[model samples]
Target: MQATQPLVGKETAFITGGASGIGRATVLRLAEDGFRVVVIDRNALQVEALVAELVQAGYDAVGHAVDVCDRSKISALIDAEARVDVMVCAAGIGPSCAFDAISDEDFRAVLEVNVLGVFIASQEAVRRMKPGGRVVTVSSRAALGGGGFAHYVASKAAVVGLTRAMAMDLRQRRIAVNSIAPGFTDTGMTRAMTPAQHAAASALEPAGRPAEPHEIANAIAFLASPRTSFITGQTIFVDGGKSLGGLGL
Candidate 1:
């Protein structure tokens, strides 16, 4: 939460999956930072409501209902925008399915949203980004290890690789690409876990609890800041020190 004023020339930011969780928190934060914000998500009603809240709060903001995997819609939205200085790809899902029970369709579905969805958004964002622009994507700590959810782990790991490659590809253009690999964050997705499951997971974190949505959003804002110009192609883990060991190190 830096001072609520324009930074790096009042740049405009586009965020995906902005209806809730980390995405929602980031939308409000960047707006506070004085960027003209555009929130894109597949949830139409939620998007509308969020935009209305931002508008009421006096932030230059708009909302669009979009499935990130739909390139046509994404292209149209980016094309309509005059400039994009920051992009945050926070749309993703992590479902827990035992490897033995996982199916092809289910696996692909996760990849479709978590992996391809991010790819589509990042590709489009890179195209519309101005020089010095920043792109922050969401990965997961599970990417660093073999987890129970193979599909989720694989897809998130792909994001880290994609982010690094994108950082290299976009360096010539002076646009930085980075990722935040959050650990055990308490969001809607985590809330879906049963109390017993949640307790068991929370016990594993060195911090002994899940992260607040705003906590992760704060890291995201920092990475999206022009101040982080020297930072690129790295995945900073915001996992309450969970990465220090929690699972089979």
Candidate 2:
């Protein structure tokens, strides 16, 4: 954990998994929106690349290579920050496996990354935050109920529940907590799917295509903005109507 550039008058946003996928998109979007962004990711090279890109683009940004599940390290990182105006929990893992065949180790791994990771990061960031701070979590539409990834679905469902509880607890402090549930999005995670699986997912989308990472980032940016002070404890679905569930007429 290297020392970040000084945070001037600008608000600071600390984001986990900000090296790629929706997390990377959010980092870019928030930086463009004028926040001094702090990116945390497990990949040191990716973190360096992103931070360099941001600095070259004239954005105040820094990157840290740390796993979100490392609670003590995450807490220390957040503690070192002058102020964390926003925290986005976007680190998660979703491996497809049949429920009957899912190993205990596999299921626990998903929960640790998806559920425990969010809890640790959010708790740490909020401790250093002021009133009106924001926390945006990334969940998935699979939480609504899906097949082949029981572990993922369960973890995301827990995130939604945690968001609601956090909102209630933090309401008096004027901090807003919300979540975004993205459908099949064009991310590295989704790109790892088999070709047939990818095609089937796209075909099932009512929008006839997977969401772009920026699309989900756009929604997250909105939730993290000052304008969303009134919106909390809600799950905004950026799933292109996949959650609507009625097949194409």
Candidate 3:
């Protein structure tokens, strides 16, 4: 790993949806960057393994299993954990189906996890963070457009809006809030697709490839760092330029 950045030392970051995928990558990135990391995820095994790995590596890391939709659990967790300098709300689900095909339960569930999850997590994080703290939420490039996945796109768009609003709301306290709008990437969720499906999805990228998990983690690290003090209320696209070309070409 590269030398840990100075802004990362002696600080703590709380992350949600951290058992696997982008959350796991962010946890490792933050740990490697010298921040004490606490992750909340629904996957007990994955969370436990990650925590153990970080411990063995001489880094401060712990994991909690909780549903992000539950406000009481979130409040209790934050109360127990006390203060954190950074919070990354990366817990979300993407159910891509046509608008009419989206069932009521599925639509609500997606909204709860993607939009309300960020709202609840950010609310708790703001309460626990110091004045110069940072909050980075994981939005999606779907926020910029609405197409095949109407429910997912709607929920993620709310994330972007919430991020911007929170940035304004938190600015007075010197706490920066931002969101990362990532394009397609190869994750466990995306692993369900056929090779042809994955290739076709990735082929839309102007950069000609899907992003690696580490790439997004690096962007989160940058946003969470004190060095990004001047940056806030923005959605940084780490999406390999896919958003630029909506065409299937």
Candidate 4:
């Protein structure tokens, strides 16, 4: 581990699903670290609020409301000449049932958000990124196995596959791609879990607690930073040692 420094200031980062959760935390972290952030989210109001907050803090940031699952919209978003230097594919969904219990519609929706969404965003970003650009996608420890939540797990496993594949394709271009698999974290995404369920999950972690959104954000920031240019095709686990705690969530 090295002391991290702000990358080239003129560089820009386009973050997807950046209105809340780990995405928003990454946006704030990147902006504060002296990178211009371009935030995209489905919630226009929340995106606006984030932009306003960043601007008030004297950070260079902007917000755009676009569905990452839509290819055309994603293409248009990255069509600018800004030439983004970093992309954080934090846009995803996990509120799904078990494989047999999930409806066709629900299963497709999960893949759309977790798998296809990352592909589209990465494709669009790659087209506009400089040679040394960085890309980091949010995955989950659930992807390691198919337990009760099959749909979510499968989708996230796809993310890890995509990360490795993209790294191979972009190696010649010097564009690094990686994924972060976080365990249970305290965020809007986990807010829906029953208190008892949350407690059970927390107890499973060797740390005896869940992680904060900022904790995950810090991992992502490291991957996106220029200091990590040599660290590609790796799935860095930020699960408070949970991945080593028997790999169950």
lDDT of 3 by residue, 126-230 (tens): 987878899999999889886778888999999999999999999999999999988887788777778998888877777767888889999999998988978
lDDT of 1 by residue, 127-191 (tens): 87778989999998999876579999999999999999999999989999999999998899999
Assess the local accuracy of residue 97 in candidate 4 as a C-alpha lDDT between 0 and 100. 67
Ranking by lDDT: 2, 1, 4, 3
TM-score of each: 0.93, 0.97, 0.92, 0.93
lDDT of 2 by residue, 1-249 (tens): 343475767899989999999999999999999998999999999999999888888898888899999988888777777778999999999999999999999999999999999999999888878899999999999889999999999999999999999999999999999999999998999999988989888888887789999999999999999888789999999988878868652
What is the clash tally of candidate 2? 0
When superposed on Cα atoms, how far off is each prediction in RMSD?
3.8, 1.3, 4.0, 4.8
Instruction: For residue 130, give model 4's deviation from the true position in Å.
Output: 1.8
Candidate 1 lDDT score relative to the true structure: 0.87
Query: Where is the poorest 10-residue window by lDDT in model 2?
Result: 1-10
**Cα distance off (Å), candidate 3, residue 130:** 1.8
Q: Per-residue CA lDDT of candidate 4, range 1-249, in tens?
A: 001222354778889999999999999999888788888899998998888888778887778788998889778766642557898999988884656788888888989999999999998898777788999999998888756678899899999999999999999999999999998888887888889988887887778888998999999999989888899999988988767756663
Between 2 and 3, whose lDDT is larger?
Answer: 2
Candidate 2 error regions (>4 Å): 1-4
On lDDT, who's better, 2 or 4? 2
Error of 3 at 226 (Å): 1.3
**Ten residues in a row with the worst lDDT in model 1?**
1-10
